[model samples]
Target: MNKTAVITGATSGFGLAAARRFAAAGWNLVLTGRREERLAQIKDELAQTSVLTLVLDVCDTEAVQAAFSGLAAPFNQVDVLINNAGLALGTEPAQACDLAQWHTMIDTNIKGLTTVTHALLPKLIETGRGASIINIGSIAANWPYPGGNVYCGTKAFVEQFSLSLRCDLAGTGVRVSCLAPGLSESEFTLVRTGGDQEAYDNLYKGAHAIQPDDIADTLLWLARLPAHLNINTLEIMPVSQSWSPFAVKRDQ
Candidate 1:
């Protein structure tokens, strides 16, 4: 029997990379993103694989519950759940922050993730073979940057919640793991910098940022581990990029 995996934020970034990797591995994929057109494009591109696309915003609690609840029978028992849909609105210090951006980050990165995980936990627990929840966190939680206050806080929640969930799901044949990445080369910087190409480019001027595929590869490894073995947490970064922002060389 083929395994099934559900991924959020499937339209781009690490989520898109993981979806492609999983499909290539012959896993049935249920992908959700806010953009229906992008989701449809991915679905069409991966037509050779069994794929389902749901265009729903994770921040919409009601929509999230309904969409997951309505999964087709075959897709209902998710073998793996990847909560990869999140964003960092702006690199603003807390005192000078845009409250709207802060709230957006909190809602999507923290509340949205928790909502989806809660909705899928029952299905995962019921899967006799066991299931895994891979939450995408950020290394910013550990090494705070100058203007990453809200984004860092949200990721800190991800780290904490993953640990708490692992404990809560103990003895239930469900595993919770967090993948915290540092300085990844993806749409992340573009989105976070609000399309300021120069600013985004400057962030990685001299850094070897990890690619989406790199993170996807890590997810695949975590998923393929022996069912008896659980990888509780993984912190991934490019060899040239240390965990601390203090080591990052910002272009003047």
Candidate 2:
């Protein structure tokens, strides 16, 4: 039987790329996102495959539960769960930050991730075929930069949480991994810059940024590994990206 995979934030970025890759690999998909139109577009694009689109805002716990509960019986034994839903609010220092943006970041990046993971853990454990939970994290968790305080903190939570989950699920046929990526060309920078196209463009001006497909390829590689072998954590950055964030030069 083809395996089933659930991916949050499936409308764009790494999530969207992963959805396409997995569908091509013959896995049934349960894709969730907040934008109905984008979700519909993705559904139409992947219409040839087995795909279920759920219009879900991961921040809303009740909505997440209801949406996942309504999934067709086939999805109950999901073989992979990808927590790719996340966001970054601003580049401001913590003291100068907007409270609303900070809260939104925490809600989506931290609480949202935890809630979905908790809700799906039982099903993963019960599935005798063994399972994988891939959490999309960031290198910011390890190397902090200006204006990345809360975002970094949230990703750090993901790193720690993934490690803890792996330990707790030991020998339970469940594997947890964190795929921390750097400088990927996605709406992430656009959203973080508050719709400033120029600023977003400046982010990748001089550097070779990793495309969403690159991260998706990494995820597929991790998922396809032998059942007994688990890749616990992976950090991927573009070749041009180096240790120092400030050293990344962009044309003015």
Provide the global lDDT of candidate 1 against the true structure.
0.89
Candidate 1 lDDT, 38-120, residue by residue in tens? 99899999987899999889999999999998888669879999999999987777888899999899999999999999888
Clashing pairs in 2: 91-147
Off by over 4 Å in 2: 245-252
Clashing pairs in 1: none
Candidate 2 Cα lDDT to native: 0.89
Error of 1 at 168 (Å): 0.9
